[model samples]
Target chain A: MSRVSSKMALAVKCSDTFNADACMHCGVCTAVCPMGIEMLPRKLFRYVQIGLEDKVKENISTIYSCLLCGMCAENCPAEVNIADNVRFLRKYINENEFNLS
Target chain B: MPLPTKDILGILADNLNQRKSVLPISSAAATRWAKGLDLPKGGKTVLYTGHLYQLIPIIDAMSGQMAKFEDSALTKYFGLGRNVNKFINMTFFMGMMASKDEQKDYDRMLRNIALLLKKADVDFGYLYGEELYSGALVYDEGVDGSFAKHAQRVADMFKKNGVEKIITVDPHTTHTLRTVFPEFVKGFDIEVKSYLEVLAESGIEPTNQITDDLSLHDSCVYARHENVVEQPRALLAKTGAKVNEPRLCGKNTHCCGGPLESLFPSESHRIAGNRVEQLKEAGGSIATMCPICLVSLRKAAKGSVKVNDLSDTLAKAYGV
Candidate 1:
């Protein structure tokens, strides 16, 4: 059984004001990433927006891997601030998971 | 080396904050800054180190802590065991590693900037033991709470000290103070200027001359984020060397890869290499505006190109 959390989605959304709902899933952010690391911004948003906590958890590497360089946001046709979203996810993951001394 | 994890980075931030800095790095740089100084004369201009230059000794030490992350427990758990070089990012453990490396060059660059500003009579001063890290690394690493607290403490210290204005040395500090602080702290008001902005405003003509072709590698923060692109070129124009432009220059500049260098070393190296290739194509000794850019780009260029901070370049121009 997989658990879903509206709280996580709400928190992530609040952390980054850019409405992921307006995302056309156009794959432009992935194309624009300098690292050429696809499967992020759009993919991560899709999982989070749907409240799939497990799926979001699974993509932790992809979420934190973003440099938050704003390159994708700069190039986004929809004007989505994907970099801030990545930063939010990173903050969410660090607080929700992981043990740090 | 094993990849740096949140646990490690968090712990390191906690530790560094406990002491207010990587003490060795700060203390060593302080020793250098104090050299050849007379009795204290108070100045209204607070020369904020932003803990970047002071942390150089620690950064050099930490950047050297590479291990076999390909087989580490974290890598195996994350399924990041393959593609060793390209996949790993540094944790704060790497950043906290203890070493005895000489911070002379780092210290020298900082001193030169201070001396140049003093020569230009900006009435600059440092906070000595009171200065704190701008929590930039923690903020960038997504450790928001730690950074917020640090920012508050730094802001409070500034208020207590009656710091009228600040001249920041690096872009990370400059950007954090100018942009990030306001968001985290209410009424986080203080006049902040990067040293380049200070120099440009001073309009001092350099007495020393450079015969070499001088090219500029703009730090992404200094160039794109802060719009401090033309000021350094203007200074170089007045000083001596004719400025050369890389393919990725000005607002469209490429990053030096330092931010990701911690999070993605191999990829950072690859980007930096590409940037260096672009810079070398423009063909000249590289002059940089940020300390991190000087380190990252120099790591890529590997001494084939002479790289220096704009502070050092101007210091030479003033025959310091």
Candidate 2:
């Protein structure tokens, strides 16, 4: 089981704290993602919400792969801040999972 | 295990004689920027070299120290600092990993800016060893405690050095010092100006002839965040660089995939690839104002197109 650290919690919290509920769960962010990354935004937040730490761990590539381009956030029909959520996930991953040493 | 940032900054402080987080690539150039040039005699401008610019030189010198990292677990994770016998190869690999070219660019960029500012008659003094990293990256990385601590240290240094007005070279530094510092450090009231803004005010004329159709990429921080959209275009126009517009130009401009490069490299490359396509489609070589953008786009272009710092474009036209 993946540890339930504050990094994971804060990463999840960013979605709600940043008002990600405004997200309509549309596939536009995934469509606009230049890299064609599959995990996308809403799927990631949902993993965090459900405390699916292992699920997040499984998609570590997608988590670190986020470009934080803000294009998705800019085009969000519901005006959710997808970029900030990805950033929060990056912080969590860097601190908890990766070699940002 | 990740290497502690304290160790990173500590080694930097030891090698550089201060804790500033400037890259090691420009260490020599940074020293030379102020060498034999009398400060306090200038037009009261303290040029602040932000993080990622000004190579430390010590990092290369400390390559020998990496020998300890050979068998270390940290090396396995970060994927280097092993193979000490081939120090030469390892060093080059480290340079590539660290984006040494970008460091060199800032050093060169500084010299060109110094030449231009001299032409503008704006006397400027670099703080040299006294200036510290504004901790901009630390904050951006969400290391809140370190950022707060480092920000205080930076503020203290400014006060200790009696710095009043500063000319910053990058938008991130300019944004942090001008906007973010006030929020973090109470009574942190100091005037911060980007060199571009200062140059814009100077109205200096360009001497080099430019005939290339250049497409300028405005940085998100520089344009949308700071409203510095016109100054660079005005400077490029003054230099006679024929400008072309990309599909996403001005405030509506698209990302260059830089901000996430460190955390998400391959994905950032994809974004850079897309941005390059947009710029190439604009029918001109790219001119970038931000250092990160220059590095990212240059990598993505793979010599297929030229991507250069706006300073180089200006340097060709106005360099002394």
CA lDDT scores, all candidates in order? 0.71, 0.65
What is the Cα-based lDDT of residue B31 in candidate 1? 48
Best by DockQ: 1
DockQ for each numbered candidate:
0.39, 0.29
Model 1, B1-320: lDDT tens per residue? Answer: 33555544554455445654422233444545647754143357788887686566566565554323323555433323222212233323433463434356777787888887777777877777667777777776667777777789989988888887988989888988998899999999899998888888887778877765877888877775678988888878866687889887786677777776555567677877888888888888898878788888888888898887778778877766
Residue B106 displacement in candidate 1 (angstroms): 0.9
The fraction of reference interface contacts (C-alpha pairs within 8 A across chains A and B) present in each candidate is 0.30, 0.28
Which lDDT tens digits does candidate 2 get at residues A1-101? 55655656665665443346676788888877666776788887777766678787777656655545556765678877775576566556555664332
Task: Give the Å error, residue B257, model 2.
Answer: 3.8
Interface RMSD of each: 2.5, 4.9
TM-score of chain A, model number 1:
0.83
Superposed model 1: Cα runs more than 4 Å off:
A1-4, A16-28, A99-101, B1-4, B22-31, B38-42, B67-102
